[model samples]
Target: MNQLEQLKKYTKVVIDSGDIENITHYTPYDATTNPSLVLKAIQMKKYEYLLQKSINYAKKKGGLKNQIVTNATDKIIVSIGAEILKKIPGVVSSEVDSRLSFNTEKSIKKAKKLISLYEVEFGIDRSRILIKLASTWECIQAAKKLEQEGIHCNLTLLFSFAQARACAESKVFLISPFVGRISDWYSINYSSNKYRSSLDPGVQSVKKIYEYYKKHDYKTIIMGASFRNIKQVLSLSGCDCLTISPELLSILQAKNKLITKKLFIPKKIYAKPIKKLSHSEFLWLHNQDPMAVEKLSQGIRQFGTDQYLLEEIVTKNM
Candidate 1:
């Protein structure tokens, strides 16, 4: 079996792309999309039809320009996700606005709206969707409420142990620890050679989180994501899931090397029962992790910018 076939035996493979065409080729179990991916896919001629359908759907609502543009952007995301769901058997994570990462109430409201679109507009069931949110304390709190309401969540841009701890405490459906982004930070501030080993900083982050959850028997899933290379993807071979780009997926499919499982459930639990993080503690711990603090903020700003660019495209067609 090729590496992709071999890896599937250990990890649930999720395709991280907005291009429905590419998603079908990988046959990934799940699909994930963010503002940046959606923006990139929207510009493609193949996905141009999705933009038109979204514009028409937005126009029917008959709102002001800003509201119409916002509605259109949401429609495009849901529409593409809805299409990807038809090809993949598992859930598709549709992200909420990154700008709402700091607002708990607004974040909850937006998440519900995205769910409604998938269920009501696209005729897709809520069970087949994972509402993607930033791993902010506010976003985690919102996910806690939504999970209680039977709305599962996939927290993204996660960097620190504090974020992982909070998500596990909240019992969110999944937490996507960005393996590649962590490696990038360390490579820039420190040295690339430092992380050249299999024990890449990004890979180490997921391993730590996975060990924590497994040792405690936490039910929340840990989905390692944002891989910059195939090494990062294969490094977390036994993770609950790994959201991989199509480029890396293709490379894995071509390689015949058999890979061993790198992570596993610990035979003995090391830590005692851990206390849940309070809001203040969560913030303080996250602040102390300079890498987490910088990356989380930078990721949100980047996503927000892509969302704005997507809206500009919609406004032009309007």
Candidate 2:
């Protein structure tokens, strides 16, 4: 078996791309797209049709220019996700606006509206979609409410154990602990050579979260995401899932290499008391983690910028 084939034995592979066409070739179980990817896709002639179609739909619905454009942008996300769902047999993680990342009420409202849009446009069931939210406290709270209402969520940009613990407590469907971003921070602030597969900061972080969740019998899925290299992907081999880019997936497909499962699925979880943090404690802990604090904010800002760029494209088309 090729590396991709071998890797699939221990973990579910999810394609992290907005190019729906690429997803068919990789045959990933799921496909994830964010604002940046959507923005890039908007410029591609292949996905250009999706942008205009959504814009026409939004304009026909009749709203103010800003409102119409915003609606169109959201519609495009759903349209692409819907098409992805057709190609991949599993869930399509469609993200909500990053601008609403910290707004609990607005995030919840937009998530629900996105769900409605998908059902109306493609008749895709809500059960098949994972609404992606930034792992802010507000977003986690929103996820709690949405989960209760049968809207499963995939928490993104997750960095710290505090976020992981809170998401587990909230019973989030999945938490994507970023591997590459964490490694990037370590490489810049510290040293790159210090972190490798066995000792990789990103690998260690996911291992910690996975062990914690397993030890506590938490059902929240752990998906190692944002991998910078194939090493990071293979490092967390036994994770519930890994969202990989098509480029790296192709790399794995070409290599007839061995995939040694670094992570063995934990059974007979360790006995320990799980601490539930108060709101203040959660805030303080989150603030204290330098990498988490910096990366989380930076990620939100970057996504927001990409979302703004996508809005521009939508507005001009409208």
Candidates in order: C-alpha RMSD to true structure? 1.2, 1.2
Per-residue C-alpha lDDT of model 2 across residues 1-318, encoded as one tens digit per residue: 999999999999999999988988988998898888888887999888898899899889987898898889989999989989999889999899988987999999999999999888889999999999999999999999999999999999999989998999889999999989998999999974657688888889999998888877889999999999988888889899999998899999999978888776577876676778777888898898999999999999999999988988887776
User: What is the alpha-carbon lDDT for the whole of candidate 1?
Assistant: 0.93
Clashing residue pair totals per candidate (backbone < 3 A): 0, 0
Q: What is candidate 1's lDDT per residue for 132-170, written digit by digit as tens? A: 999999999999999999999999999999999999999
Q: lDDT of each prediction vs. the true structure? A: 0.93, 0.91
TM-score of each: 0.98, 0.97
- Deviating ranges (above 4 Å) for candidate 2: 192-194, 270-273
What's model 2's TM-score?
A: 0.97
Error of 2 at 269 (Å): 2.4
TM-score of candidate 1 relative to the true fold: 0.98
